[model samples]
Target: MIRALALTLTLAPAGMAGAFELGFPVDCTLGETCFIQNYFDHDTGPGMQDFTCGPLTYDGHDGTDIRLPTTAWMEAGVAIHPVAPGRVKGLRDGMPDIAKDDPAAPALNGRDCGNGVVIDHGGGWETQYCHMKFGTVTVKAGDQVGRKTVLGKIGLSGNTVFPHLHLAVRKNGVEVDPFTPDAPTTCSAAPDPTTDLWEDPIPYDSFGFLDAGITDAAPDYAAVKAGLPPRLEFAPDTPALVIWAFFFGAKAGDVLTLRLKGPEETVVDQAVTIDRTQAQAMQFTGRKLRGSWPLGDYVGTLILTRDGVALEQRTLSATVK
Candidate 1:
């Protein structure tokens, strides 16, 4: 059973002069069945068992299993919306989901970060929504969103034991406990010189930020259509490589294909079918491709299409040595 936070705490004063008021990512009603897992202290330690990924065993109690009521809604399309106004900063798409039994899976992984979006609310403060349904993200990098803007739907796409929004507020680029009383005080008292900034986003409900309203706009198909073919740029490193890709003109329910080719045109192909209803990123490791390649030159191409019609394509080259 998930523990619920008591509803009687005073809202933390918005930190940093110019810090934006953040919103809740879901339409959580008072007394509704919504709970935050791993809100603070996510890393493993005493009393902190990993809940994101599984092999979950806690004193003979399987931890991954959520103790649900006899009638629980485990349906897959809960909408994930922006909690505050911000600009889209980063996104990833075309990554594969980690296997349920993969022992190496983190409580969160690139794929479990399925179709994610990062929104920067200024002052170096950002919010990230992960494990979203494929292709449902309604915002893109560089686009601006208001408090009620729908971002995507919640799903178990990435490294998640259950469907829930993974949210955090960063100060100087590091995740800090928003609920900590001394967070704002500490951040306000002594500012970090290296980054020279501080941020604190009060978790929804913990304060009095409640569901105000929902914006019902037609799905942004133009933005969706613009993300069709995924584009990749690769830079080689001595033993490892850096690969980045941009996907555009894509929609929910579209199937995307990715291929990495080496000399002689040897191809390693992988495919990801997107749930266009959501706006998110798809990213993954080329572990299979890496296993087969010798340290040398390579090229990657990503193709997007639906119902046999070619949508878009992008290609890039890299060196592995």
Candidate 2:
């Protein structure tokens, strides 16, 4: 029951931009990717707002949730990096990376942030990295960290259904939108100030314009909400593979397409027209390949378009044997 509204783009005067610049916190290449799972919320009980005043965030969310596609990726050691140069301000560790289903997990509380590190960059700026893998906090309090410094490995050590690093940036103790630190608060003026945050900010579209990937099987968000891992990667000799793509801030009149191209052929191609706008929607298509299965790379692509304009297009690949 979502509806699209005409997009209104805004940019603050160049004179009002911030002096600070940041970097992305994770290291990814090629087949590996990262995306914003949740964004800093700007609204109260009625609705939600992300740094971009987009629907990528949830109500009450106070930080950016940068995420990997699977916990297996987290377990294999995806290092979490600091976005700015700073000195470690606080450090906490030793929380086991336990799933919520494990009764042994610590009672959710202040512990919800789990093993993490907070770095204070002078001039009243600070950044906090939460949900780090247990025992992977490499920097102790007062340690100096440079941009992209490896502080820890990402993990599910706290109150989260997914494995990610919850990055909270603050200015003099007040939460700030890294994307629009120069303009007024997003709660006040959205379309987030055009003032970019990163030294070379990766625009929202570059990373998320299309948040998509291949799953070991079909994901039922119902099960995902019930504490189940929604994604699984394609395994060697598996019976089948599911391709799911998620489009964010999709408006009416947009056409969504999901395609699966195997080693030798186009296995599945599905498309649906958005009758109304949606904050996010998952479109999935899968196949049980015949014979012994392909022995090379399988690619999945998702493309979204509106009135012949390409809004977002991305592709992910999985090597299978």
Candidate 3:
């Protein structure tokens, strides 16, 4: 279960003097090619909370983390763009895109922001883009840039275990949540976006599918995170057929349904109610072969429901050859 904050609070004073609007910072399509992995931590004390008063953030986390579903996506390149026009104040490059936990990773030594760039948007406002890939920084320290400028590609660098762009917005020198620039003093309700800094409102998203696939047996979690290509076909004599899903933002009591069907018969159908809140989760269902699977196409579907509302569904296909 998610740990809840105990203190009661109220909204902070409205508005920042001369605050400006910002645009989406990535080149990929939202929800399809990239997802918001974390948001600015709004909790003033020890516990963490996002602008929506959710557990999508870590304690003292001061940025919104935009992530790709796989390292392969990162390797293929996902461009990082500025959220607004600004003058490049400073930049870093040439940091290899390696997970911090990898045996070959370099020491952090305070370079946790990894290969990053900082831009000054005037009026004491600035933005920082972090965890960028090596040799991808395109602008010099003093370049004037527009929102369309490609600063770099997101990467698994710095203090990060995954590939993402940790974007931090600031004013003067203090960190600010672009989603709630007014600095609401309470987590009582979702912030009113009328006062937010986004030129277009970015919806507050908490849950969805990250990856799904089919295989002949149980899949490894590490391999899923590494974005291994899924097995598209199985042999007739394979031991079992497995359907698995990788997702994020699971809440207690949420229901997950996994169903598999062959051209001639339904193989496995199961629904599971989650018992605890999880930032990320995985589930699978499979059945051992009864001699051999019928030679045909197979489809696997995953559905996530919260409060009886079907929130997401995804499907993968395979064939017996």
Give the TM-scores of the predictions, in the order they appear. 0.42, 0.69, 0.90
lDDT of 3 at 11: 27
Residue pairs of candidate 3 with colliding backbone atoms? 12-185
Candidate 3: stretches off by over 4 Å: 1-14
Model 1 lDDT per residue over 113-174, tens place: 56678888886667777766556777778999887788876544565544455665554555
What lDDT does candidate 2 reach at residue 90?
96
**Deviation from truth (RMSD, Å), model 1:** 21.2
lDDT of each: 0.45, 0.69, 0.83
Q: Model 1, stretches more than 4 Å misplaced?
A: 1-20, 42-76, 94-112, 181-321
Displacement of residue 315 (Cα, Å) in model 3 is 2.2
- TM-score winner: 3
Each candidate structure's count of clashing pairs: 34, 1, 1
Q: Give model 3's TM-score versus the native structure.
A: 0.90
The CA lDDT at 170 in model 1 is 56
Q: After superposition, how far is residue 210 of candidate 2 from its true place, in Å?
A: 8.3
Candidate 3 residue-wise lDDT, 1-321, digit = tens = 111332222222346723688889988877878889888777778878788888888877878898888788888999998989989999988778888888999987778899999999998889999999888889999999999899999988898877899998877766777777776334536577787788886877678788889887888888888786978989999999989998877889999999999999998999999999887778998999998899999999999999999988998899998
